[model samples]
Target chain A: MDTGSSPKERVVTDQDAQNITRVEELAYELKISQVMTREIRSLTPDMNMGDVLDIFRSQRVSGAPVLVNGELAGILSIEDIIRALRAVDLASPVSKYMSSQVMTIHDYDPVIEALKVFVKSNYGRLPVVDENNKLVGIITKGDITRGLLNALQHVYHEEEVIRYRASHLFEDIISDRTSLILRYRIKHGDFTHGGNASANIKRALLRLGANPQIARRCGIAIYEAEMNLIIHTNNGGTIRVEIEPHQISLEAYDDGPGIPNIQLAMQPGYSTASEEVREKGFGAGMGLVNIKRCVDDMRLESSTISGTNLRLKIFLREKDAFADVSQQGKETKK
Target chain B: MKIVELVKLVNGTVLVQGDRQDRDIKGGFGADLMSDVLASIQPDAVLLTGLCNPQVVRTAQVADVAAIVFVRGKNPPIETIRLADQEGIPLISSPYGMFELAGRLYKAGLPSFEKSVDPDCSCE
Candidate 1:
């Protein structure tokens, strides 16, 4: 049978890719102990088959591990119980009907390892043993599913809580106008932390409920400005950002070794960067140009005697506003 | 296209399988200049570059790049790999040059991530 082509052979849909990756990552990340059933019922070898059936029926469990002297000796499944009933030998001890060979999994092993064992064997459940060889729990396929769902929910909850708290910032304030200001001091030639400011800015915007497109545009714009400070200025620069309900303003400025020609610097391919800087994958002269594309307003000021200052702004449309004005308006209506 | 298929097409080796191997790459962008990449490339596109450095991962993070493919078998240093893993950005190295890798991905229907820059229209 041609068990269909590999997943790599076909283009994966966005939803499918996300779902498969989440589950696959969880399977390897979660340990068997985290998901296994801790309170498991075990049967003693000397218990009669009829008594085992009564225990199984009352507990609503189809199978259980059998212990001899507190050591795992076998597993008695529903199938074994059926065979005992077929022979009308309800009086036989569980040891006579139970499968003597048992498969066990270590509690510290990842859930994926348990899945591999389950696929290889026909057993409905595997007894989980700790490092000391003591049976700690039991695991089934259902447990894996529940474990994955809980992990997914936990991640979702964390992000949602952060977003919820941030999105409410503007709503709690009482003022004619409210704004948040963020400032960063960038050091020259600090390639190691070049984009750190921009990444944080983008994350803040996202948590504040800004749409992704707005966050991305601001992120790219600030990243370019931040790199300029690292690559060009004699000393480092300062980036200042002001965020309001309707607009965002960003400014970057540095002292001396200013742009000699602002017009030429604005051109796409113009560059004054040395060979050393070029080899490190920067100084293509597209920084200002890229920043222009992402913002609504762009300004450049320079005097070789003093310094260079660049300013950018993005205006948010009503639909794209992140502040909780609508929620405040609803409260006022009551 | 999925990142795994693109990796196979370019004869690439994964240096860091950040977050997921099956991440959906919506498009492709090839550039050695990080500024150009930050300016023009759209989000979720795979980046192809010959410059192997930690900054490449940094640029990918700021630009929301889905993955990075180091062309011409350029192995980025361990710093780059560690940064990518921390940020959950997939890193791959391809034996093929930028031109060849871009051509194959384009032929395989991976759209270009960049918007054409119009000369007449001032970006400002």
Candidate 2:
């Protein structure tokens, strides 16, 4: 149309030129942090979970940072709140259940890096920390969306972008009868004690009459998470297991350095373990991969600044519902 | 052998209602790890373990094992026994260690047939 109607070329006015320059500046400056809204209100570790719930309702923040002696001690996320309300007795203090090791960030970290943390952790929000590890501000999933909006318009690693959402995809068989919630602190490099938390979950599921399949899925996911801590994080962290009637959800966390290249870590046979772990017949680096294969829904989120926090949700299949599915063979015996 | 027959073999004292001995038994496996047993076991089989842990009995209950015989004369924890009793799985005590007891059963035609690995087994 310009070739026919216009004599030469329409000039970009001064205002349009200014607009283009502004866009360029914003394009360069819009890291993930640009979309992040800073949230600073938090709860002390000593506060009751009830207070945390109230804060969630009153402030409308997805989660709040928990402090101890004015230092970042833990986090109370919506998932934590959901687990507590569903499983824990309301009267209990947060100290009995609050997540101690948490994912955090420095305000200066590029927004792209922060997105990596959220992607690895599956947590909508992460705490911002100062050099002294004190709570400064907070970042949320909203920040991620805004950052992506400002990113270069071209699709970068479209397939690699983690997009699976549990609630959005399939309504997991959510039955509280088999569901339970257990929170515990993990110690470092204690492989012998690694399976304890998962064992406790299996026991609870049995007591709650969880279907064998659901229970087994829960066991596998939880066991992998426990072993991840022992092998990767010399200092163990924390795990919260939620047993729904049809699904078992495990949230395993550690304050260890978050995975920088989750894409590489998720690849089969990927491992960062030392020689000692390989000798123990462990750390083939199939833990998360196996967890994914066994579970119907798998989620992971992490960042380099804070440690890794993972959430795995596995639904019960029909096979585990049967009491003894393994007894059948090519030649049946009795 | 059936649970009733296994009970006879072990010379066990039936502390709970052993009526479920009528339950079908297609095979038998002996192990201690709940996940291991749960991962490979089938229902109606006789389970032999010396773990004495509550999780052992829970595993038996979940896997639908018809009976559990504690080897090495070991006794399952009280909670485990209680759970077995509730689930109607027979619980027994054997003075023989797992290797001795399993060997005897194998020799008596209860062979240690390797279970086929489930390619999609969630409990790796």
Which whole-number lDDT from 0 to 100 does residue A56 have in model 2?
81
lDDT of 1 by residue, A1-334 (tens): 3222234343333322332244577899999999999998999999999999999999999999999788999899999999999999999999999988888899999999999988897878999999998999999988998998999888779989999999888766755668999999999999888888998899899899888889888988999899899999999999999998779999999996999999999988899988988998888888888888889999999989889999999998878886655664566677
TM-score of 2: 0.38
Candidate 1 segments whose C-alpha is farther than 4 A from its true place: A1-33, A49-63, A67-92, A95-136, A140-142, A255-257, A260-264, A302-308, A324-334, B14-26, B119-124
Instruction: State the displacement of the C-alpha of residue A97, model 1, in Å, after optimal TM-score superposition.
Output: 7.5
Which residue ranges in model 2 land beyond 4 Å of their true spot?
A1-212, A219-248, A256-293, A297-308, A315-334, B13-22, B32-35, B58-64, B76-89, B103-114, B118-124
lDDT of 2 at A281: 43
Candidate 1 colliding pairs, count: 0
TM-score of chain A of each: 0.73, 0.41
Q: Can you tell me the CAPRI class of model 2?
A: incorrect
* Per-residue lDDT over A78-134 for candidate 2, one digit per residue giving the tens place of the 0 to 100 score: 777777789866567776677787878876666656666766867778887767766
How far in Å is the alpha carbon of A240 misplaced in model 2? 4.3
Instruction: List model 1 lDDT by residue over B3-113, tens digit each.
Output: 778778887767767776677899999999888787778888999999888889888987889999999878777677767877788887777788888888998999998
